[model samples]
Target: MHLILTGATGLVGSGVLHAMLTTPTVSKISILSRRPVPMAEGHAKAHVIIHKDYTNYPSELMQQLRDADGCVWAQGISQNKVGKELKRNREYIEITHTYPLLFARALAASTAPKPVTFIYVSGEGATTSPGRFTPIFGVTKGRTETDLLALSKEAGSNLRAISLRPGGVDPTHHKEIAGFYPQRTGIEGIGGLILPVLRTVYSAMVSPTRDLGRVLTELAMGDGAPLSGRGVEGEGRTVTNVGMRRLAGL
Candidate 1:
């Protein structure tokens, strides 16, 4: 299967990319990033595309995407990374919501080799029904998932959209192969040190990067059947952390 991936430099995206590269079923991987992906360099199956704007997809780029069977969207940012609230909100919405939506729409409009599958790498806490204490990140991501599912419903068998919600993705655990696993620092590093304890306490809360990657790859390669008009927590569409672990045989 030929797949398109975004944010190949990030923690989650890198893991997904690694799985794609290693899997014999995946014939090609198109990586869209602002800069060159070091991990993709020298790999015959990896094609790195320097795309500056995610909101707009030029005809040339769309043509390339049209040939692909599916897309694994892992582009996103932490809320704490941005200093100002206004900028953070804007960046979060654009990166997490707008970019993937635009890409999906573009693919839906064009002809494809087959029904295109779009796998969104969402987080655990995302929800459409926001309480008084819900974070802005969750609210935006939830809305994005809702919109994507709605779009898929409209598109019928032409396009399929699915969201994978993983919590506390542990980057340390993966296949003993060449892959991009970033060095954790600060709070993330500390969390890595106690991952076993966290897993014991909250088994469903932590997802090993390898497991998450495998699940994403499987979905992209059409492991499960299409959605049966279910809601966001549908059988084939939305997968939680526990679902991911189960899919990966963890």
Candidate 2:
């Protein structure tokens, strides 16, 4: 399958890139990033496209995306970054919400690929129902989710948009967190005791980055694999971390 990947430099995106590279079923990969992806080099099927802006894509780049079967949009900013900074909020919203929607629209318009799959990496805290009490981050992301779902429901549209609400994704170095359930003790030891306890607590809600990547890639592939039709209107489109872990066989 031909795939288009964004945010290859991020923690989860890097793992997704690794999974895609190793997966024999993937025939071609197109990476869109501001800077070239370091790991993409030397891979025959990998094409790294450098672009300063995601909002305005050149015709050539759009042409390449037109031929791809699916896209994995992992591009996003941290909640802190999106919330604390005013300038960054606007910039990030444009990048996170507007750009991906534009890309999906262009992909949907392309006729070369009959059907296109889009998997968006969203946070588990996102909620469509919001009020004065809701956090701004969740509200912003939830709005994006609503728009993407609306896009999926477009009349006779060939785009399948899936939002993945993965919880904390353990970094590569902390991958061991996913392996064991922690045992908390009341007796506090040395200064290092807090770290283990925190890891245990974190592991309960977090998933390994590798596993998240595998699930994202598998869902994007649209093989007779388990994740197909997951984004269809009636079916559950927003996948949580538990669902992601199950899909990744973790």
Candidate 3:
């Protein structure tokens, strides 16, 4: 199947791209990005579309997207950059919602609105409840989730939608991105080391970034399950070294 995706440059997205390339059923992939992703030694049919602005992406590109079976939306800025970065959390939400909506609309307008599922990547603690305080991000993600669900309902049986919410991603990186903050550091790092212990003692749960990616890809290729309002649970999901070990076995 031909798949369209966003945010291939980011840490989480890059992992998603890696896993997707090996999926036997997924032959063609169109990654929406501002810049191209440099592929590893071998990957087949990974198309990078450099569309500068989703808001103003040409109709030709939209047509190209509609031709694809579905999309994996992994776009948006991080919450840590709220005060420091040029674009804040709210803008992040807008872009996230807008990009996916464009894909959904394009799919609906097509003559064959086949079983094209949209797998949206939200964040941990994205509230279903209104008026929660979560560093402005709660507001942004909450609204974005609401919008995606609404889009699915509006389409009725025409579109299938699913949401993934993963927390504290630890991308396998050699060097930290100069100024960017790592998700788990010092105390958080210490926490990761002893997390499996805590899990055994207190019955805790977490996930590895790779496992999260695997789980997401699994969800995208839905297993005869009907679409519901449920977002895939990844709460308290820390990508610790042990989780990494567990994933290696899989």
Candidate 4:
């Protein structure tokens, strides 16, 4: 199946990329990256499109997304900017608001079938209720979730949208971007003792990169066409690492 993915360079997105690549069912994986991403040779159908601006997407590729089988949208930055950082808040709003909405619109305007899905990566701390807090990370996430869900609901013709609210993706491979987040688990024995608990929880509540990718791959691979429709509104899903591996039979 042909798939499209964003944030190909971030920790979560990189893990998702690895998971999709290892899965045999995925034929082509297209990435919307700000810069060209480096991947190994013979990786399962990979395409890297260098597009710095996610807000202003190319019209031609918007049409091409119609033929895509699925999308794993892992874009957006993690933030904890508070107080004197109101500008940062504005930037967050711009990214979450314009980028996801525009991309979803582009995909919808493409061809029929709506490409089956467009999985959005969100945060676990987001509240189902509406309220804004200082350093409003959750507020941004909650708003994004609401907007995307609305977009999906209105998108007829078999379009589906799902949000993954992972607590913190423990990258077993990449280590550089770990410092980007305040809650990040970096190497050098910083968050060392936490790995075991993370490992166990990942096996249950969290969806590991490999497992989440497999689930998405399975859906994209046409494993269960009917089952893929169960989104947050339809069935509500929040994958932990443990649950991810178990579902993938790892």
Candidate 5:
């Protein structure tokens, strides 16, 4: 299968990239990033595309993406990174909602013979409900999920969209890949220690980075039963961390 991946430099994206590169079934991988990906280097199947703009896809880029069978969208930013409230909200909406939606819409309009699956790496607390205390991150991500699912329904057999909502993604499970990024410190460092305990006592609260990557790859390759509505009814299109663990057989 040919696949397109975004945010290949991030922890989650790096894990997914590793899974894709190692899997024999995945024949080609198109990596979209602002800069070159180190892990993709020297890999024969990896194709790095330096795309500065996510909201706009040039015709040439669209043509290349049209040939792919699926996309694993891992692009996102932490709310704490963007300074000030106004700028943070704007950047969050653009990155979390606008970018992936534009890409999905473009692919849904394609005339490819086979169906294109889009796996969105969403978080656990994302919700569409409006509230006075709701965070902008949750609102944008929830809206994105709803819009992507609606688009999939409209596109029917041509496009399929699935959202994986994971909480506290632990990167320590795959040190070989996670080592590429800087070590977590402060609150993140503390969370890392507690994540393993959560995995054993309450698995839904956390997911190993490797497991998340493998499950995303499985969904992208259309090799899992969950893609066929075998999971819980009404929520098959959206899988929780618990479901992800089950699919990954962890």
Candidate 6:
């Protein structure tokens, strides 16, 4: 199956890209990124699109995406960078909320076959409800989840939207990217110890990033049961960390 992947350079997305590259089931992978993605060298099936703007899509780009079977949206930013970063609020909202919604609409309008899957990478604590007390990250992500689910249920739409909420991702199996990992610090060092302890205890609060990637690839490839049996309409569902673990065979 051919698949379009956003944020292919990020931690979780990079893992997904790696897993898909080695999987025999997936024939082609189109990575949409601001810069050329590393580790895609010598892979004939890997197609890298160095897109500078996420806010807009040219007709030609849309045409390329329309031919794909599915998309995995792993683009997002941490809430901690709201004001400290340059216009990060807008950037976060654009990447996390607006871009996915727009892409979903375009894909839905496309002539691709029915039941096209769109997997969105959300967070563990995201809520469907937004309020004044809600953090900007949660508010934006929650709204995106809600809207995507609604879109899935729309008549004549062939999109099946699924949200994955993973927590405390363990990046041991991931390749080292220059700016992906945080600089070593006291708290970061402590997390190193804590992650191993949690894994030893089989804590469900954390998930291996590699496993998360595998689960997403399985879903995109339709490796399991049908998403729904309710007529010909598409479906929407959310998978938490535990569900992701089960899907990952962890």
Give one digit per residue, the lDDT tens place, for model 1 in 1-250: 8898998898888888888989999999999999989888888999999999999998998888777888889998876555565644678788889999998888877744367888998888998687888887888888888888888778354678899898887875565433555666776677678888878898777888777887798788883355432223754578778777777777
Off by over 4 Å in 4: 40-44, 81-84, 113-115, 131-135, 155-158, 173-193, 200-207, 219-250
Model 6, runs deviating above 4 Å: 84-89, 130-132, 174-193, 223-236
lDDT of every predicted structure (CA atoms): 0.80, 0.72, 0.59, 0.61, 0.80, 0.75
lDDT digits (tens) for residues 1-250 of candidate 4: 7788887676567667776777776777888878766652355478887787777877777766668877877887645332346545667777755688788777766745544676777766665465545335667766777776677667364556666666545555344334332344344245445656866765344444545555555544442122322223324433333334544675
Total clashing pairs for each candidate: 0, 0, 0, 13, 0, 0
Q: Candidate 3 — which residues are off by over 4 angstroms?
A: 40-42, 83-90, 155-157, 172-205, 223-250
Candidate 2, clashing residue pairs? Answer: none
Q: What is candidate 5's lDDT per residue for 142-225, written digit by digit as tens?
A: 888888888777834477888888788888658769555546676667767888798789876777888888889888888323
> Model 1, which residues run further than 4 Å from truth?
155-157, 175-182, 185-194, 227-232
2 versus 3: better TM-score goes to? 2
Candidate 5's TM-score reads: 0.90
* Cα displacement (Å) at residue 85, model 5: 2.3
In the range 1-250, model 3's lDDT, one tens digit per residue, is 7777787776667667766777888778888888767742245678888888776656677677676666667776655544445244346655656666776666656514566666777766666565634555666666666666666667354556666665555443313221222355555566557656644563223444455555556555553134332222323222222333343353
Tens-digit lDDT track of model 6 for 51-124: 88877777888787677777888877665544556343677788789999988887767734556788888877
Worst 10 residues of 5 by lDDT: 224-233
